[model samples]
Target: MAEFIEHNLQGVDSAILAVPVALAEGIVWEDLARMVKDEKMAGNPIAGLIDKLHFEKNCMIEVVLALSAHANSQRWYELKKSQERKQGKTFTPHKKAFKLAEKKIHLQLSQV
Candidate 1:
């Protein structure tokens, strides 16, 4: 999953899932626009909802600033080195770079 994000969803179903989800369930843009025009949506529900989604999705912060290959090659190795030094444990091939990016993004969004 992490690699997919870093590399972009080339053939993943997520790319398709994001569309309707973001437009309908995620943002509810049409209803939101109606509410805003009619003054029914108080305090900007659309903006609030978008902020919430971005927070949940973690589009704000990123852990590794590189492509999938770079992340796998250099960043992962560096992370392993740090882990070895800090915790004296062997580096496990578990963490995914895209997942790390998502985590960082979520953390920053939550702070906001």
Candidate 2:
């Protein structure tokens, strides 16, 4: 049997999912909007939910900045991991550093 994973984002608006998922899926706003429209036409009920969603300008900006920081941290982590692998060293430190950097970035984002 396959394991079932569920996310419980109680009290969190579903609109927030758009930013992270879009970034992960490499979809821009225009493309995502078009895809949503196509899905709605195809009778996907979830797609219709986007139509009712609205985010404040500041919230959108923050999401975009947070996503950018996440991407940067991911790249830094990958580079450090690769360099450590080449030197036959453990990557534990690199992983810790990445976590710390990510935490700092998030803190800065929260302050804005």
Candidate 3:
């Protein structure tokens, strides 16, 4: 999931199931919440919900949905930000760059 936030790589779907089950198996996720809080969400509003879910430790369907959505939304936000940076004038783009960037951003929009 670190790859998701920093690089916009939405690795595997297993973490959605694995995390809560790990919690039920006695894993402590305060570290995740603390790291998330410290890292900041870069503007994802629901990112804080994961911290609350960790406390409840219920693994209910809604909790699962919230966790999944939070992760997806965070990943989406990072991808969007990356697109913005790529579009900026920091460097010259090749002739096909606009077309390719648009296609990539389109894929980013479908992440959730």
Candidate 4:
């Protein structure tokens, strides 16, 4: 995962900085799924992140979406989980999912 992040971040410019924050802001799963399926952002890095979030866990769409939205940092996950608990939605995260999200955050932060 680290290798993948390093490779992807190479040659990437400052524009990537906004991605983590945007992702952190929270996105609807349908919108994220659409972005992955849409051809317009097929080769875009953000699309890659969307795709990674969707496919990495082999979980349901809702789970993937939740994980992706909470990918800003480890603390974000805890906060999101707290919010979900209050709202009665389950937000269980596997170790691999956290690692993937952390690596993604690291990659985006590196651009800054």
User: Considering every candidate listed, which one attains the maximal TM-score?
Assistant: 2
| lDDT, model 3, position 9 | 21
lDDT (10s digit) by residue, model 3, range 1-112 = 3333333223223335545555677757776455446544664433433334445744422233334545655756677789889877455566468779998999999995
Number of clashing pairs per prediction, in order: 2, 0, 0, 0
Write out the backbone clash pairs for model 2: none
How does candidate 3 score on lDDT?
0.51
List runs of model 4 lying over 4 Å from the truth: 10-26, 39-41, 54-112
Choose the strongest candidate by lDDT: 3
Scanning candidate 2 in windows of ten residues, the lowest lDDT window is 1-10
Q: Which tens-of-lDDT digit does each residue in 12-80 have in candidate 4?
A: 222234333445679554564565557336675444443333335432322322333234234445666
Candidates 1 and 3, the one with greater TM-score: 3
* Pairs of residues clashing in candidate 1: 2-98, 58-105
Q: Which run of 10 residues does model 1 get worst, by summed lDDT?
A: 45-54
Off by over 4 Å in 2: 1-15, 52-112
lDDT of each: 0.42, 0.50, 0.51, 0.46
Q: Candidate 2 on 6-105: residue-level lDDT in tens?
A: 1212212343555457757887666766776887799864564344322334233222223333443454566667887876555677888999999999
Flag the better candidate by lDDT, 1 or 3. 3
lDDT of 1 by residue, 14-107 (tens): 3233334556565664553454344424553222222112233322123221233334345545766777786643333334655788899999
Look at candidate 4 and tell me the lDDT of residue 103.
100
